[model samples]
Target: MKYVQLGNSGLIVSKLAFGAMTFGYGNIPSVYKVGQDQSQELVDRALAAGINFFDTADAYADGQSEEMLGRLLGARRKETVIATKAGNRMGPGLVQSGLSRKHLFDACDASLARLNTDYIDLYIVHKTDPFTPLEETLGALNDLVRQGKARYIGYSNWPAWMAAQAVQIQHERRWATFINGQMYYSLVGRDIEHDTVPFMNNCGVGLTVWSPLAGGFLSGKYTRDNLSDPNNRLSGFDFLPLDKEWGFTVLDAVREIAQNHSATPAQVSLAWLLSQSHVCSVLVGSSKPSQLDDNLSAVDLQLTSEETAKLNELTRPVPLYPNWFTTMTLDGRVVEALK
Candidate 1:
């Protein structure tokens, strides 16, 4: 139940955010589980465990995630912080998508109605909206804050440069700025280490990591040989683009550490993220109570410094372009070897 500041904002949020992406079903949603009753039970358990942040998206389950979250929150909605995303296509029409003022306004109202709440604690842009100008998107988001539709703003699945541009636009126009980052970060997928993580820390934005387990690969479910059956989401969706060879290498290191610590691979994977200084919160979604409990246990799991260094060595990314040049060129305060 540890808490941290949400980006630069003064508001404190739980380290583990309840992800409601699995709250719906049917043809539109690629991955959906836990119906209303089940979702309600999970919500209760999460709240009991001191998780006050809940995240969902309009496109999930065709707006079912929002509906379910709102219904479950009911009278206790004010006790928790609710965050949902926009900018994804909600319908087949041309105007039903992007960051246009029309879509932004309509989407917020729709989310508000669905959630049965007047205002959202944090509203995020789900992805880059190339069709709309950044200024237009920022203006619309600013209007939402003024109208009390949303209290704060955030962005997800955006590149470092795009995020920087958005922040610049906000600064120049005095528009609502993004206070947090909701991005895919995991022990197995260390791609964000190249740019996103550094940029986020520089901008003083809190990071709420999604897919901290690399879609169950770090959950200790699939191994080199055991991955034969392609039934699970990772096998079926093939999302987050995990590097199997590199992933297995990291998992071998994780196995040794987990054995020494008497923890699960999943727990070690999550603890690895929690150990990072820039990570403000980790978004975790589960279908069962047991799964949620196991995930929650990560907040208490502590990896020794030696274990962390070994994990980092196995998963560290190859520096790309300017990063290589910059590190090679920068002269900073260096410690001399003690003779």
Candidate 2:
């Protein structure tokens, strides 16, 4: 039910964004089997729980996700902040993908059609397109805003350096800059802390975290003994790359904290992310109503400082080269004084 402004933008969004990746049936039949009826029920539950932010992508379920979300939202489309992504191959043709001007325009129009909406609340580039010039991509996105096709633009799965450069270009051109960055961030996958977090902090950009459960490893269903559950997405998809040993160690801490609070491990894991100040929202997708309910309840689960510290220590990322060198050479007294 909590809301926050997305980065420095005026747009206010729910802290927990309902991801519509499971809205339609497609290639991953096992993972995304929720049909229209079930999708509606899940959406209803999410809305009832005060979740106004909904996220989907044209690439998810081969565009079925956007179609189903559109159909379910129906009259309530204007009540929610809907976000979708492009730059992913929606078809087999080479021209059907990337952040090229042609692809971005075509994809945005198609998404609008599928979602049955006039303008997207947020349009993100799903992934980087090295072959296309950054200017081409940024210019096309800016044009979308100018034409009223999209209200805002963002990028996902992009390197920190690339995002910084794009922001600078947009600033120089006096165009609409990105308000947020969606990336994989979890207790087990703290890789974003190295550069992405610092870059976003410097640029005043918010973060939307995907796969906060570390592919279900932090969902409390997986253990050292039961690591292969056929029904679990991690067992089949394994999308987010993580250190299993480190993940399990963090899971143990989460399990302990969950027991103390009488909350589900999933809730504890999500609460850890929700407690972060820079994170604007955490995306949670589910095929079942109960799963959605569980995720929504995480907004209410406040972890104690002691518990948060334990989890943070257990899952903290190892400082990389420059960070380590700076910390080692810098004078602690001077840094303390500056702080």
Candidate 3:
């Protein structure tokens, strides 16, 4: 139910964004099996619980995610902030994908029709298109805002350096720059901390965490002996690469903290991310209503400083290159002036 301004923008968004990624049976049948009836129930529950921000993508479930979300929201479409992405291949043809001016322009119009909305609250570049010129992508996105097709634009799953360059280009052109980002950040995956986190912090961009559960790895259902569950998405998708041994070590601590708070390990894992200042919202794309309810309750689970410290220290990403070099060379800000 808590809200904050999305990145640098004035538009307020819920701290927990309901992702419709699992709302339909498409390419990823195992994960996206929640049909219309169940999707309706889940969407209703999320809205009733005060979630006003919904996220989907043109690529998710082969665009069925967007369609189902549109149908589910129905008359309440205007009441929520709808975000969708392009640049991911929605079809087999070369012209059907990429961030080229041709593909992006056609993609936006297609997304609008699928979502059944006039303008997207936040339109995003789902993935990088290396073959396309950066200017072509940036200019096309700027045009989306200018034409009222999209109100804001952002990037997901992009490298920190590439994101910075895009921002520079957008700023130089006096166009709309990315105010928010959707990145894979979870208790099990802290890789973004080495670079992306600092980049977003300095750039004043808000972050919405995707795969906050590490593709269900942190659900506490998997143990050292039982690594794969046929019923879980990890068995099929297995996308987010993780250090399993390290994950178990962190999960042990998460379980203890969850026990102390009378909560589930999943909620504790989400609460750890929610406690982070840089995280504007955490996407919950659970197929099961019970699981979604569990995730929604995470906003209320406040971990103690001691608990938060334990989890942070356990899952902290090791400093890389200049990050380590810079920290090793800090000086002058000792106890002199303040004392």
- Each model's C-alpha lDDT? 0.89, 0.91, 0.90
lDDT of 1 at 53: 96
TM accuracy, model 1: 0.95
Deviating ranges (above 4 Å) for candidate 1: 28-30, 332-339
Candidate 3 lowest-lDDT run of ten = 330-339
Tens digit of lDDT per residue, candidate 2, span 207-298?
A: 99998887777888887776776766777677677778777877888888999998999999999999988799999988889888988889
Question: What's the candidate order when arranged by decreasing TM-score?
Answer: 2, 3, 1
lDDT ranking of the models: 2, 3, 1
Residue-wise lDDT of candidate 1 within 47-121, one digit each (tens)? 999999999999888899999999998898988999999998899899999999999999999999999999999
**On TM-score, who's better, 1 or 3?**
3
After TM-score superposition, the amount by which residue 103's alpha carbon in candidate 2 deviates from its true location, in angstroms, is 0.3
lDDT of 3 by residue, 1-339 (tens): 899999888979999999988878876776888989999999999999999999999988888889989999999998999999999887789899999999999999999999999999999999898899989999999999999999999999999999999898888989989998899999878888889988999998889999898888888887887777676567788877777887899889999999999999999999999999989999998898999999999999999999998888887788899999988887757635666
